[model samples]
Structures are given as C-alpha cells and as structure tokens.
Target: MTAADDSPVHQGRRAALVRQLRARGIANEAVLTALGLVPRHLFFDSGLLPQAYQDKAFPIGAGQTISQPYTVAYQSALLAPQPGDRVLEIGTGSGYQACVLVALGAEVHTIELEPSLSARAGRLLARLGASATLYVGDGSVGLPTVAPFSGILVTAGARRVPPALLRQLAVGGRLVVPVGPADGIQRMLRIERESATAFRQETFADFRFVPLRGAEAVAPAPSQSGAETIRSAES
Candidate 1:
C-alpha cells in the first residue's frame, strides 16, 4: 500500500519488529519508539512490502539497500540525538533513517548522491508529514553550508572518516559511520567531537555496507593525527 495506509496489520508488524529490535540489544527506548512509529513498509515498493518488516535489508534501487532495521536502530542509539538536535544524514537512501531521526524530534537535514533516490525519499517523507530538508549532492563531503551539526549519520562504508564530516560537527556532536576496507566487513565507529581539535572514538560490532562513493571511495593517506581517544566494544 501507500504511506497513508498504516492499517492494523502494518502496525502489528511494526510493533513486532520493535520487539525484535529490543531483544537484539536495541535498548534505547527513544530509538525503539521512533522505529515503532515509522511505517517501514511505506519505504518499500508495493511488491516488496512483504519483506518490509523482516529486519533485513532490501534493495532500494541505484545499487543501495534500505539498511536493516537493526542497523538503523543501532546507529540511532549511538548518535543519541536529543530533541531539537540538528542532525545531518549522509546517503538518505530510502529516507527511512531520516524519518527515524525526525521521529526522535531532531531537526533533520539529509543528502543523497543519487538524485532519483533523493527525489523518491523526499516525496515519501513529505507524504508522511516528516519535516526533513533534503539535498542531492556528494554526501561524503557533507553539507558544509549547514555545518556544525549536533549529530551526523553516514549510511555507507568508508575506509576512513572524512575530515570534512568531522569538521562539520559541532563541539560535542557525534558522527556515526562505518570504516574499513570496501570489500570487507566494516567496524561501526562513533566519533564524538570533544573539542576544537580532539575527538573520542568508540568502535562497535562489524557490519557490511555498500561502499561509500564519490570522494570517499578513494582511501585517504594517513597523516599527522589529531588528539583522540579510542575505545572498542570488542576490546
């Protein structure tokens, strides 16, 4: 059905998905609630609706997949956006993540590299009454015109954190992204801007994502480091 068709069946499936997410270690109530409220089925093509609430990723065209529900909730919990937090999302994808961020009461600004995907997501978001500013461009470099975001979420895999994204974060802001070889599993990293020149990094479980494209596809050479602290969940 359409976004407006949030029937009992859809609601029930959505609730079941939420429970599954909780059981899988998504403990943040706010993130769970947001996921519960967002009609994931609406983000899928009518023919793909059957698999919408399966907690699995599905192709969303243009070589990208609507991230599995667990991954979305996991990253949202890591970002921990407060109400009214200004958040930037790279790769808008199905705009499902942006809707989750909106449901969390954040001011959302999302950019996508694929114009068609961005257009489709914008229409869906508008239909659902989610207020998120959508842009079409190279998301790896981020939306600098609206820099200093309170939180940033990247939905793709990269070899290293883009310096531009880091520079766009407001002090205390968090950038949640996946970093690793393009052909291998990636570690989910939550990098928090502690100050003008210092950042704190936390590494989480491994996840495989479509390689981030555009300027981020080419790994950058290692350079002089900045002051940073790292903690790995696997440590």
Candidate 2:
C-alpha cells in the first residue's frame, strides 16, 4: 500500500476496500482491519493503482500478480491467526498478504525466492512500521529453524504440497494454498494437521496464482542463489 499523506480521497478508498471485502463474505474483524490497513494500491504497479480496491488482482512485477482481495481474504479466513501466532508465508510478493496476517495479529515469518522482490517487500513492510522476519530463500523448503508455525500460507501455486512445509507445520496447525496446474485449473486448498505424520486436505474454489518455484522444482543451477521464483501451475 502507498503513503496516504492524509488525502481524504485515499482514506475514502480505504473504507471502500473494507466494504468490498465484506461484500465478498469476509466478516472477520481482524481480516477486515488488515485489508483496510494495507494499501493495496501501493503494492501494485503505479498504472494499476486506480483499481487496487476493486477486489481484483493486479500485476506487481516479475510476471507475478498480487493476489485478488477475495483470494487473500478467503485464505486468511482459513488461517485464523491469533495474537503472537507464528505464521509462515510462501511467496511474499508485495508483502500485502503478510501485512494482512500481521493485521490479524500473527508474527509473520515469510520466505521469498526472488531477491529483488524480497528486498522491496522488506523495505515496504519496514516503512509501514511493521517488522517481519523476511527470508530471501525458497518458500518450498520453508524455514526449518522456524518450524512448528501456528499457521502457514503459500501465496504461490504448488504442483503438490511441499513435504518440507508439512514437516514444519505444528501438530494441529493449518495451511492454506492453491493446488493445481498453473496453466490450466487450480483449486484453493486448505490442509489441517491431524498429527505429525498426517494431514487432511480440502479443496476450495478454483483460482490462479504465480507458480511456486525453487530448487525442488528443478535442480539448483550453480549460478543461482535464492533466485528461484517460478509461477508454477499448481497440480
């Protein structure tokens, strides 16, 4: 989101975003608060800022698009983050989703494979006075040292759930991601931990997302160091 500078017009738009989110069936106070606080326009291309609160997705850069408001809200509703809950986010494109999680009171630990995007988002979050542990690393592997997160969210689409992420999920924790082919069809999926070794996965409505890319998608090219960010068609 962008700096408001106390413009009445911009403040009006923020209120409208909240109403739009509510119309889309997001009733959670924390979710609404997050959506309202996040400057969606600041997270998108300057040319696309006018439509930021229109409840649609907009291109950010690197061929990746900040997800639509509803998709963000849908997954967030499922995340159910509580105060101080450590949440892991995959694909921290513009830090919008992570901002939302923070609004919902989660302590965010986000991984982004693209260095430039990671750096930009880190700066943006810091500028907003929010602090999150930003890791310029593969989201697929997750942050092993920060395992046992209370909640996990994959902003990108994955061919299948990454096993490493599953291993990091705390027992009874939940994860929400998009699962399907990137080019064809994708379904929003939510996974709930049944035990350390088991999880129950449920598919939500169809959606689209940037593909999840990392060393797991292909062997690590020696020249690459945390440079993978593929818009994988989730399978």
Candidate closest to the true structure, highest TM-score: 1
Give candidates' CA RMSD values in order: 2.2, 6.6
Tens digit of per-residue lDDT, candidate 2, span 5-37: 436676688898789878878888888888877
What TM-score would candidate 2 get against the native?
0.87
- Model 1 lDDT per residue over 1-235, tens place: 3635898899999999999999999999999999999999999998999999998999999999999999999999999999999999999999999999999999999999999999999999999999999999999899899988999999999888887888899999999999998899999999888888778888899999999997855746446565244444355
Worst-scoring 10-residue span by lDDT in model 1: 226-235
lDDT at position 83, candidate 1 = 98
List per-prediction Cα lDDT, in the order shown: 0.92, 0.80
lDDT minimum window of 10 residues, candidate 2? 226-235
| Residue 178 lDDT in candidate 2 | 84
Indicate which candidate wins on lDDT: 1
